[model samples]
Target: MHRRSFDRFNWQDVLREIPPSHIATRVSFFLAGFLMALWASLVPFVKSALGLDEGAFGAVLLSIGFGALVTMPLSGILIGRSGAKKVLAFAVPVASSLLVAAALVPAALPSTAAVVVILFCFGAFFGAIDVGMNIHSVVVEARSGRKLLSGFHALYSIGGVAGAGLMTLLQTAGLPGVGSACALSMLSAVVWLFAGRAMLPDAGRNAESDGHGGPKFVFPKGVVLFLGAVCFILFLVEGSILDWGALFLMDEKGAALEHAGMGFAIFSVAMTVMRFVGDRVIMSIGPKRTVVFGAAAAAFAFVLAVLSPNAWTAAAAFFLVGLGTANIVPIAFAATGEQKEMPMSLAMSAATTLGYAGLLTGPAAIGVLAEATSLSTAFLSEAVLLAAVAAAAALTSVFRKS
Candidate 1:
C-alpha cells in the first residue's frame, strides 16, 4: 500500500499543495517533547508509589535506555523501508499507550518487573518516534532550502517546558499522577491525529537513490564518528542538567529544595531562547565556529557553575551553559543530513544512538563519580569533556565547510 502511494506521489506537487507540512513537522517535534516531559514529571510520584529504593528505581530507569538502544538502529531501517510517516503512526500511539500503562503501574502491576517491561516498551516506541520525526525534519528542511532545524528544536524545548510545567501544576492542584498521565497521553494522541495528516507522506522513501536498497547497517565512520562524539558530549551535558543540576544546587550551592529547580529553569529558558535565534548565529559564524565557541562557552560556564558560592550564581552559570549547548546538536544534525558517506537515515541513526547513550548514562556516571570523589569533581570532569569536544569540533572537517 505504501509502495503504491509512493509510486503515485509527486514531490513537487506535494510541496506546492501541502502548505501545512512544516507546521505538522513542528507539531510532531512538540508532541515528542511534551510526552517525554510529562513522563519525567511523573517519575517521582511513580517511584514513591512503587516504594522502590534508589537502586531499584535506578534499575527501572535503565530499562528505558536499554530499550532505546535496542530499537534506535532499527528505526533507520524501518524509516528507509516504510517511510517516517507510517513508522510514526505506529510508534507514537504505542508510546502513548505505554505511558498510560506506566502511569497505572503503581496500582495495576504487582511487581517492579512489570513496570520495567512497560517502561522498556515505552522507550522502544519513543526512540523510534524520535528518529522518525528527525528524519522527517531533515527532509522538510532540505525541501525548504533554508536553516529551520534550530526553530524546530526550539519548539521541542518549549513543549518540554510547557508539558512539565502544566503537569506539575495539575498535580500540585491535587490531580493524581495516573489522571495527569492519562490526560496528557490523550492530548498527545489528539495532536498526533491532526498533525499526522499534514506530515510529508513517505518522506524517507527516497533516502537512497536506488530506493531503500542501501546497506543494512551503517556504523559511524570518519567524520560521522567525530560528529557523534561531539553529540555524545553535548547530550551528556544536557542529561546531566536535567538529572543532576538541581541536586547540585541543593547539595553544593545551599539552595533550598523548592528553589533547586531554578537552575534547570534558567538553563532551559536560555536554551530555548538561543535556539530561537540559532539559525541566524549559524548563518553568521557557520557551524564550525558556532560549535567551537559554543563548546568553549559551555565548558567555561561549567567551571563557573562549579565554583559558584551561591545558588543564584550557579543558576547564572547554568544559563550560560544552556546558551552554549543549545545549537550544537541542531548544527550537528544539519551536518549529518548533508554528509555524503552514508545514507542520511543511517548517519542520523548512528549519531542519535551514541548521543542518546550519553544522555542515558551521564547521570549515573556522575553519581558514581560523586560517590568516589565529589559532585564538584564530577562536574569538573564534565568541563574537561566539553573542552575535548571543543578541540574535536575545531579539528573536524565536517563543519568546516558549513
Candidate 2:
C-alpha cells in the first residue's frame, strides 16, 4: 500500500499481497472498457440477428440504461456494507457470464426479446463492476498518498482503446459475431479470476464492528452534492464524446465511414496522455486550481469544437476537450473521500451513482435534443454545461484553501 512496502515485500509476499490488488484494478479496468466496446461492436450483429430496425435497436439500448439505473443504487449499498472486493468478486463473474450469454442468445434464439433481456442483465452487471472497481482504486490511492489515481484511470481508457480497436479489427478480419463476443468474455473472465486474490482486504466489517459507525445508507451532504454535480457535468461531456463524436463527424462534417472513429480516437489518445501527466500537474497546481482551470479549459474546448468548420479543427477540439477533462473527475473523487459529513464509503457511493448517471444518460439526452434541432445545438449545449461547471468551481473556490 505504501512506496516502502513495494521493495520490502518478498516475491511470495508480493504475489500474495500486491499482485492480486494490482491485477484486480487492471482486470477491472480492462473488462469495463471491453464491455463498452462490446455494445458498439455487436450493434450491427444484434440488428441483423434480431431483425430489428433502428427504432427497435434504440429501444433495446434503452433497456440497458434502465437496467443500469435499477442496479446502481443497490450495488452502491452492497459495496458500502460489504466492501469492494466482495462485491467485485461476485460482480466480475456475473458480468462475464452475461456477456457470454448475450453473445449466445442471438444465435440460439435470434429474437429481439432475447437480446433485450440479455442486454439488461449485461448492463446491471457492468454497473456493479464499475462501482466496485472504483471503490478499490480509491482505497489503494488513499493508502499510497500520491497521484496514482489518475494513472489508474488511464488504464481504463487504455482498455477502452484496446476494446474498440480489437472489435473493429476482429470484425474486419471476418470473425463471426458470437465468436468475437465469446473471445472478449473469456479473456475478461480469465483476467478477473487471476487478479482476485490481490484485492485490498475489505475493511467494511472491521469498520462497522469497531464502532466508528458507518452510515445506515449512502447519501451526500451539501458540499458533496456540489462536487457530485460537478462530476455529473464533466462526465456528461465525456459521454458525449464517447457516443456522439463519431456521429457528429459523419453526419455533420461528411466524414467517411472509415474515418468516423477518428474523433473519439483523438479524444481518447489525448485524454490518456493528459492523465499520465496529471499527477505532477495536480501536485504542482493543487486540486482546487486544477478543477477551476480544467473546467474553464474544457468549456473553451467545447466552444471551439462546436464552432470549428473543418473536421481537422473539430478533431483538435476534441483532443483539447479530453486534455481539459483528464483530471477533473479524479480530483472530485479525491475531494469526496476527504469530505467529513458522512461515512466515506456511503458518501462516495452517492457521489459515484449520480455522476455515473450523467455518463449514462447525457448522451441520449443530447441525441434527443439534436433530433428536435441540430447536432451543433446539442454540442453547444454541452459547452454551456461545462461553463456551468466553471461557475460552480468559482463558487467552491476549489482553488482556495479549505
Candidate 3:
C-alpha cells in the first residue's frame, strides 16, 4: 500500500483526502492515550476498593502488561490477514468499554481475580488498537510524503495530558471514578465511530493477501531486530521516568511527596512540546541525525537528572530527558514500516512487541538494580544504555534517507 502511494502527493491530496485519513489515525492514538489516562486516574480508587497493598497492587499491574504482551504480536498478523481499518474499528470501541469496566469492577465485586480479568481484557484490546493505529499512521504518513508521524504522535502525548486533567476536573465537579471513566469512554466511542470511515481500507491488506504474504510472523532479524532493540532501550528510558521518577525526586532530590508528581508532569509537557516540533526537526535534519542527537541528549539528561543538587534542578533535567526522547519512537516506527526484511504489518508487530516488552520490564528492572545498588546507579545505567542507543543509531542502516 505504501510503496504504491508514495509516487506523489499534491495539495489536492493533502487538502481533499489527507485530512480524513490523518483524522482517522489520529483519533486512534488520542483515544488510546485518553482512555489510558482515565484508567491511571482511577488507580487509587481501584486499589482501595480491591483491598490490595502496594506489593499486591504491583503484582496486579503486571496483568495489564501480560495481556498487552500476549496480544500485541497477534495484532500485526490480524491486520495482515484482515486490515487495520477493521481491527481498529473493533479494538478502539472495545478498549474504551473495558476502561469503564476496569473502573466499575472494584465497586461491583472488589475481587482481585475480577479486577485482573477486566484489566487484562482492557490491555489486550488496547494493545491491538495501539499496533493497528501505528500501522495505519505509517501508511498515512508515507502516502502524504511528509513528516507527519511526529505530529500524529504529538496528539497521543497531548491526549495523555488532556485526559488526566480532564478526569481530575470531572472528579472535582463531583463525578466519581466510575462516572469519569464512563464520560471519557463515551467521548472515545464517538471518535471511533466517526473515524472508522476514513481509515485506509487496504492499508495492510494489499501487502498481506494470499500468494504475496510471508509467514505467520516475521522474525525481528538483522535491521528489524536492531531497530527493535533501539526502541526497547528508548522505551526503557521512558518507563523509568514514568515509574520511578517521582521516587527519585522524593528520596534522592529532597522533593515533597505532593511536589514530586510535578517531575512527570514537567517531563510530559516537555515531550509534548518537542513532539509538536519534531516533524519539522525530522524534516530538517532527517531521521539518522534526529535519533543520533536525540539519544545523546537524553543520555546527558539522565545523568544530570541523577546528579543535580536539588529536586527543581532534577525536574528540569527530566524535562530535557523527555524532550530528547520524544521523537525517537516515532522515528523508529517510520523506519520499520519501510523495511523489506518482512511484511510491513508483521515487522511493525515485532518492533512494537519488543518495545512494549521494555515497558513491561523497565520498572521492575530498575527496582532490582536499585535494590542491589542504588537509584542513582540504576539511572546512570540507563544513561549508559542511552549512549549505546545513540551509537547504534549512528552505525545502523535501519535509518534511511527520508
Candidate 4:
C-alpha cells in the first residue's frame, strides 16, 4: 500500500504540490508594471535630452500605442502555440532591454526617429508579455480553484508605485537617465531570472487545443464582448485618475502645486489596498453584485469629487473612486477565462486590447470635452459612463455566474 501510494505521485503531481506558479505570476505582473513605470518616470528626461517638441513627443508616444495594438491580437496566437511561460521568458527581457535602449538613445544617438522605433518595439514586447502574464494568471487561478487575479493585479499596482518612487529617488540622487534605466534593467533581469524558473510549463496547452488552433484572430463577441466593454469603462476611469486627477484638484479645487498629486496618490493607495482584499470581496458578494455596486459607487464618487468645493473633499472622493473601481477589471478577466464561447487566451487578449484602447483614448476624450465645455463637465460625462457600466453589470449573465 505504501509503495502504491508513493508510485501515484508523478512529476506533474510534484509540480502541483509545490505550486510556485501563483508566486511567479505575481512577480511577472510586478516586473511588467515596474518596467513600464520606470520608463514613464524617465520620459521627461528623454524628451529634454532628445530635444523633441510637444508635437514630436506626442507622435513618439503614439507609436507605443500603435505598436501595442499591432501586437496584442497576435500575442494570443503566439501564447497558444508556445505557451505563456515560454513567451514571457522571451518577451519580458526583450521589453526591459528595449526600455534601457530607449533611455540610452537620448544620450548616445539622440534621434527622434530612433527613439520612436525603439519605443514602438518596446511597446510590442510589453504588450505581448502583458497578454502572456494574464493568460498564465488564469491558468494558475484555475488550478488553485480560488480567486487570485485580484491579488496578482494588486502586485502590479504596488510595483508601479515602487518603480516610480525608486526611479525618482535615483534621479534625484544625481543619476542620469541612462544610469537609472540601466539600474532598472539590471533589477528586472534579476527578478525575471529568479521567477521565470517557477512559471507553469505548458500553461495554455489545453486552451490552444480547445478549438483555437487556427490562423485567424479571434475577436471578442457575445459575453466576452460585454465583459470587455465593462473593462473598457473601468480602464477609462483608471486612466482618468492617473492623467487628470491631479489637474482636477489643482485647477478646480485650488490645491497647491505641491499638493496637486495628492488626489491620485490617495486613489492609488486606496485602489491597491482594496485590490489586495478583492478576492475575499468577490467570494463573499459574487462578481455580479461586486461589479454592479462597485460601478455605482465609482460613478457616485466621481460626481462627488467633481462637485466637492475643497481639495480635501475631492481627495476623499477620489479615495472612494479607488475602492469602487479596484476589482472590476479582475472580475471581468475572471469571467473571460471561464467563458465558453472562445478560448481563454483569445478571449482575454481581445478583452485586454479593448480595455487598453479605452485607457489610451480616455485622457484625450477628457481633454476634448474639457476644451469644449469644462473639466467638471468632462468628469460628469465619465460618471455617466460609469453608471452605464453599472447597469450593464447588473444585467449581464456572465457577471452573474462569475
Candidate RMSDs in Å, in order, are: 7.3, 4.8, 5.9, 5.6
lDDT leader: 3
lDDT of each residue in 256-351, candidate 4, tens digit only: 999999988899899999999999999999989988898899899989998899999999999999999999998888888888888777888898
Q: Considering TM-score, which of the candidate structures 1 and 3 is the better prediction for this target? A: 3
Ranking according to TM-score, highest score first: 3, 4, 1, 2
Highest-scoring model, TM-score: 3
Give lDDT: candidate 1, residue 29.
88
Those runs of model 3 whose alpha carbons end farther than 4 Å from true positions after fitting are 1-18, 206-214
In order of listing, the candidates' clash counts read 0, 3, 0, 0
lDDT scores of the candidates, listed in order: 0.86, 0.77, 0.86, 0.86
Model 3: per-residue Cα lDDT over 32-60, one tens digit each:
88888888898998999998999999889
Model 3 worst lDDT window (10 residues): 206-215
lDDT of 2 by residue, 5-93 (tens): 87686888656665456667766776788777776677777678788888878888887777776777676667666787887788887
Clashing pairs in 1: none
Worst 10 residues of 2 by lDDT: 203-212
Predict model 3's lDDT versus the native.
0.86
